[model samples]
Target: MPTKSTRVPTHASTPVKRRPGGRSARVQDAVYSAVGKLMATQRPDQITVPMVAELADVNPTSVYRRWGDIDALLEEVAVAAFTREDEVLPDTGSLEGDLREWARVITDDIVRPHRTRYLRAMVNARDGVVLDACPCWTARREQLAEMISRAHTRGERTPSVEQVLDHVIAPLYHHVVFALPADTAYAERLVDDVLSMRSAESR
Candidate 1:
């Protein structure tokens, strides 16, 4: 938690260190907030750097210095926003239910103009830094592993985490990114297909 004075205060005074939980963190929070606020009513193309700077009460140079360009900022902010939503993996007592829910949410996000814009930007990030910066990537894989572990405990045949990702989750991501149709039914079927397959060539 941040103190009242440090909770997104203007940086016209002394500069804050860009470390986690510092003034720099507050600035990031404010900027993300400003982006969210603007995104609710406007399309991604309509959002400008100066507009975000104004909404965030920070300098345009600051925004430019940290994120490079509007599209870059959108990518970072969008990843952060979506990452927060999946912090708690779904557990509807069955893996199929959980997979379906996750797929629906992702599919819906992909169709949203604003969310998709940032996702596309991230997909084009050749440096591969954005995915590493996002906690969601690792956490999501872990959640899937946990789900498999639970099924194994129930005497059900289970695949490894990598198998699940490769056969199930990765396909859904491919569909969404490539603009293919992947609805809830498709999501459930993919999960079922993967889960039913034999692992380690034992079949």
Candidate 2:
């Protein structure tokens, strides 16, 4: 994981250029939806570009052209599915409340059966290649940065974004990936732990 001082890279592998809106948006949505449906019944290895193309009612060439291969497609789909880009950030008048709500929302989302499968599939698709940047991770980091900034503006002492990611967000996903319990209590504990780090620093 990159530290607070280190800049994160902007792309995973090669940057995939996607055309936004109109037919392009529709096709992308269809393909993403197809991948989700397939993941419900089949493992990541069992799914193929052709299967997705057929299910999505789009040409295989379209999938190939836009996403390259099945693994790439799966990665893109997982990134899209995992990040809540459209939602508003949690602002509960304090950094603690924001972190707890954010963690709770994440825990609730990733603990679902389908989401767990998607996460596993995304990991498997990586095939051991360490990415300097992942869209999903970047999105979460950006959200955290915003939340942290808000807290700063409100005169609340808070942990660095990296600290939050390391102590809270990372552990939540770690538990999910490892099939460990990542319940509401676990998320709340993580929030408390990270907040405690700030208190410890102040002391």
lDDT of 2 by residue, 104-191 (tens): 8889989988788888888888886987766677778888889989988999888887788889888888899889999989999989
For all candidates, the clash counts are 0, 0
- Candidate 2 residue runs with Cα over 4 Å from true position: 1-19, 198-203
lDDT of 1 by residue, 7-38 (tens): 12221234333335767686787887788778
Candidate 1 colliding pairs: none
> What would the TM-score be for candidate 2 when compared with the true structure?
0.84
Against the true structure, what is every candidate's RMSD?
Answer: 7.0, 6.8
- Please estimate how well model 1 matches the true structure, expressed as its whole-model Cα lDDT: 0.65
Candidate 2 clashing pairs, residues 3+ apart or interchain: none
Q: Whole-model Cα lDDT per candidate? A: 0.65, 0.78
